[model samples]
Structures are given as structure tokens and as C-alpha cells.
Target: MIAMTALAGPPADTLWATSLRRWNALCWVLFAMMAVGLATMDGPAGSRYTALALLGSVVLCYAVLDRFPDNPAIRPHVYLSVLAVALGGLAYLRSNYAALFMVTLPHYWMFGRTPRASMGFLGLATVGTVAGSVLRQDGWTVEFFSETVVSTLIVVAVGVLIGLWAHSVVAQSTERARLIVELEQTQAQLSEAHQRQGAADERERLAREIHDTLAQGFASIIVLAEAARAGLDSDTARSAQQLRSIESTARENLAEARELVGSAHRPGQTAAGSVARTLRRTLNRFTEDTGLTVDAELTDLVCDQQTRIALLRCTQESLANVRKHARASTVGVVLTRQAHGVELEITDDGTGFVVEESTGFGLDGMRKRLAELGGRLTVTSSVGDGTRVLALIPMAFEAPGEGEAER
Candidate 1:
């Protein structure tokens, strides 16, 4: 016998484990009743005692096997053999105890491990019980065959049909349970993947916001500070003006940083003045800081918040690029209300390079921002030539009244 402490009990199938428990209880009840009958029933003392011992041995073997059902050392076939012998002996010892053989039929199906194996054991038990009864009789009598053999065959046939049906049901139920567990695991994995993608998209958005706002501001400060330092001795009045521009750029950068941290505005959306007014203000600031001449033709236009913000950001990014890369003396900004949409164009007479070779983030960010609002950006430039950036956004609103003049 294996040590009880090392055994993990029965299988993990809840339905099978529960059925085994109930089967065990039924076996115990039958054993107790048989033991009481054998103790008091009229029979030869030695035969009755021998039959009682066999019955007790059968119950004890079953109890030990049930206690460590998964133990490798204890084989189920050995128990079935013992049970067959006990049923045959009981039939021979007392004809009244023959019902025990019928009651033990389910044990074959439960422990046989397969339908074929269980049917083999059931046949063995049936033949043994009948042979024992015949050997104790005078001859092959008609009454005995009719009363015992026929009834036992009928009971065996019914048990076989019931066992096969039960096995089919259990197999289907186990398959369904496995599929349900796999489905839940798949759903959890998909949910985790979506969350990771959302986080990645949010990070890309924040990078664009910084590139368009605070980063541009800080670059302006650096340029103004350099100019102020260089002209400090020779051009005192000009140096003072450059220092003031640096201070103003730093304050604007601070505000932009606060807005980013607070998440005050949705990406690509802002609450600002009219589109023309905003562009004019940005152009005026650029002219002041760079000492470059700016010719502006901006018309007051009514549009949605997103459209206005997109146009303003394009102008700002264009001016910043001009300040850093363009060595041009004059810049031109044109804003017009078209038939179906609005357009803003910025042209600079700068030392330009090929458009295809340029891989700056500002131009791409501007394109993406406009694309989100169903707008488009076009850039035309080449070596030794100037650059032109045109942004067009489709809208359905009528142009503002003629009283609203160009800025």
C-alpha cells in the first residue's frame, strides 16, 4: 500500500468525483445489510462464516482503493476480480443472497476505465454467479434457468445501455468546459493589446504638441539671447529690444508648458480669435523678433474652432521655420475665403532646399493636424529658390460681410 500522505486523492473532474462518493456510500449500505443477514440467517456455521469473510474482504478492498484512487500501485482490475469471486461465493453459500450480484453491476462500469473493459467484467461476474448456483443444484433445472439466468441477462443488457449513454454525455460536457476557458483567455489578451495601442497613440500626440508649441518658443528665446549678447557693446538700444523679446518668448513658453501639463485643450483644438486676426498677430510678432519685412493679406473669415486652430498653427510653424532656416528679408502671408473652403499661403524668399529631401517634424506635424480636419498642405521649394506653404481646409459657411476688411 502507498503512504496516505503522498496521495493527492481522486481526479479533478467534479462530476465524476461526486458520483464516486455517492457510489461508495451505496456500497457501504449494501455491505452492512449483508453482514447482518449472514450473522443471523439459517445456514451451516462454517459456510456462513466463510461467506461473511469474503463479503468483508470485498468492502475492505474497495475502501482502500477509494482512499487513494490515483495511486499507481493499486490496479482497478485486481479489485474487480476480487468482487467477482465474492459474488460467486455468496451465491453458492446462500441462494437468498443472489441479489448482491445484481446490485454490484454498476461497479463494473464505474471502475472498468472503458466500455469494453467494463462489459468484460460484467460478463465475468454474471457467468461466475450462474455457474456457482448451477453447481449447487441437482441438475440444469428449467425453474432455475427461467428465474435466475433470464433475469440476470435482462439486467446486464439494461446496465450496458445506460453506461454507454452516460459516458457520451460526460465527454461532451468536458469538451465545452475546455473551450469556454480558452475563450476567456483569448478575450483578456485582446483587451491588453488594445490598451497598449491606445497608450502608444497618446504618446505620439503629446510629442506633436510639444514640437508645435513649447519647443518653438524655446528656440526663439535662444536666437534672441544670442543676438542681444552680440550687439550689447555696439548697439545698446537694439540689444535692449532683443532682451525684451527673449523675456516675452520665455513667458509664452512657460504658459504653453502649464497648458500641456494641465491638459487644458484637446489636441488640434483651441479657443482663439478669428482666423485672420490670429494669423496677423503671429506675423506681426515674427516681424518684430526677426527684423524681417512681412507683407500680409489676411481676410476675416468665420469658421469652426478646429479649423481656426489648424490655420493658426500652420502659420506659426511656417514663421518659426523661416526664422531658423530662411535667410530671407521679406515674408508674405495670404489668407482668402474660397468658393468651398478657406486657404492660407506663406511664401519666403529664403535659401531653400529640395522639398523631398526635407524630413523636419514641423512640416509633417502641420500636415497631420490639417489632415485630421479634412484639410491638406502643399510645399514647393528647390535649391537656391524660396519656399511656399499652402494650407486649404474645406468648409460650407459663407464669407464674412464686406465691412470686415483685410488685415
Candidate 2:
């Protein structure tokens, strides 16, 4: 006849509250059956009626407390006190009623707010039941001692052990729930951090693309337009030639802009040919635009598309720097296939500045691009001397798609 209480674990949800309600219903059924049996049993009329009144009072108190669980005025300890008193009075009326004391054990554990409080109420209930039964016999008797006192002590000892075990189970369940919540929160934060890092990498890539392609084309157009205007009063044919060059540069710039925005082939992807032919075409264009003497030795090499693109970009950036600041007349480009990989070297006999002091974005961009391809760039120059830009790339580098899939 042990009663059950609300399980102390995670916060009560709809399912948990529903289960608790069902348990309360079962307790009510047991109490109702006990009341009916007591009414039918034969006994002294006065004692029977008094015991019935006490049972009715206990039922009323339990019902009120259960209905208003959160009411500050109706406390659990008050209901336990009334229950203990009724159990003792019933046991005194008829020694047979001492059996009901066993059924009362769980009520103390269920209603008491703490372990110490529950133990206190349990002890009080046991003493009350045993004392009343002993007094009803009017003297010390072995039958009363064996049935009432000994059995009550055994029940109390077993109930204490069960209560302690239930408390430990609830404690472990609560701790596990707390750890699960913390783990979910940590995973969410890691996901957000990864997204932020991805966005930043994308922005850096776009900035480098704009600097290498569209920015250089626009510079070419500006220079060509100014040259055409200057030569118009002196030579009409040459002025017309310069104007055509401007138009050609403007058109190339437009195509580069569309590719960057449309997410189609990137800027260097449109340059169709081997790495050698690509550098040859770029050198020819530089000579045409700047009228600088160019000595080029290129080797037709086999490599990945990204390697070709990186070499082309490095060549373009080096020539741009020479055109803007080198003030050199002869530009030399040499592309050779080594044992490990391909190498591209561009040297200009121009007035160069100290490499360490230069903070231009073009050089930094080239270094970052080559590094991404498992390559490196080395620039050697000094004041009044020419600058040499060399780029080296590994041949065994993974393709972009293959590398991503493996990860």
C-alpha cells in the first residue's frame, strides 16, 4: 500500500504532469476502498463511529491539500500531521486497524519537503500507531508487542532505504539533463563561428580578383585615352591608333567585369592556351601598350588550371608594377619547367625601390594567391637596381573540387 510521489527530474512537461495526475487518482481509489471496508466491519458502535469520523477528516485534509498544491496557507506538513493522528486513533479503536499503518509510510515521504522532514514525520507516525495499540490492551502483552511494535519498526526501516534510493535516482537524472542542454548550446556557437569565417574568406577572394583584372584594365584605358589626346595635334594616324587601343582595352575590361559578376569563368579562365602561350600573349600585349623592349623565353609546361591561372596573374601584376613605377625600358620573362614544378621569372631593368618598404596591395595579393596553390613568390630588388619577381608552384597540388570532397 506504499504511495508514490511526483518524480523529481527534469522540469515537468505535459506528459509528466499527466502521469502525476494518474498516480493521484490511484491513491484516491485506494483510500475510498479502505473507507468502505471500515464502514462494513463489525465493532463497538461508539468506537466505530469515532474511527469513521477520523477517517473522514483525514480524507478531507488530503483532498484539500492535493487540490491547492501551490497555496501557501495549505502546507504538506499540516496534512501529514492530521494523517498521523487519524491512524493512531483508528489503531486504538480496533487493533486490526494497525494494518493501516503500513499503508501510511509512503504518504510521509511524498509530502515531506526534505529527507530530514520526511524522516521526522515517519517517526512520529510510527510512535503514534504503536503507542495507541499498546495502550488499548491496558497492559504489556506479547501478542501486542510482536504484532504492533516489531512489525512497525521493520516497515519503517525498509521505507527509509527505499526513499534514499529514489532520491539518488532523481539527482542523477537532473544532472544528465543539465549536461545535454550545455552541449547543444556549445554546438550552436561553433556553427555560427564557422559561418562567419567562411564569409570573411569569400570577401578577401573578391577583393584580390578586382585588383588583378578590372583595376589593371581601367588603368590601361586611362593611359591610352590621354596618349591619344596628346598625339592628336601632332600625328593624326598615331592618334587614331591610340584611340583604337583605348576601345580594345575598354572592351576587355567590360568582359572581365561580366565574368566577375556573373560567376562564370574567372578572369584568367578566358585565356585559352598552355601556360607558355598564355605568358607569350600577355608579354606581346605589354610590349604593344607600353612600347617597352621585351625579351621572353617560355616553355610549354603541363600543369593544373589553377597553376596556369596563378602564373598568369603573377606575370600581369609584375608588368603592371613595372609600367607604373619601374620606369624600365627592357622587361624579360622566362618560364621554365623544373624537376619539381614550373617556375616563372620576370625581371625589369628599371629604377626599383626597396622591397621591404613597398606596401602595395598587388604584391601582397600575388603572395596570398600563390600560397593558396601551395606555392610561393619571391621578389628581389633595391634602390637604382632592377626588380625580379619569381613564382614557384608544386606540381602535386590537389584540384579544388577533389580537395573539398576529401574534407
TM-scores of the candidates in the order shown:
0.74, 0.77
Give every collision pair in model 2: none
Off by over 4 Å in 1: 1-42, 69-154, 264-273, 295-311, 329-347, 367-380, 388-406
Ten-residue stretch with the least lDDT total in model 1: 1-10
TM-score (C-alpha) between model 2 and the true structure: 0.77
Over 120-203, each residue of candidate 2 has an lDDT whose tens digit, in order, gives: 988888888888887788888888788778888998999888776666766788788888889889888888888998788778
lDDT for each candidate structure: 0.80, 0.81
Question: What does candidate 1's lDDT look like per residue over 1-407, in tens digits?
Answer: 01111112334678866765776676567666866586458778888788878888887888888888899999888899899988888777777667877667767877787788988988888888888788777579899999988988898788787767656655666676688789989899999999999887678767888988888888988898999999999999999998998888888889878878877455555543578777777777798899999999887887777788789889889999889888888999998888868899999999987889889999999999989889899999876788999999997765447226475
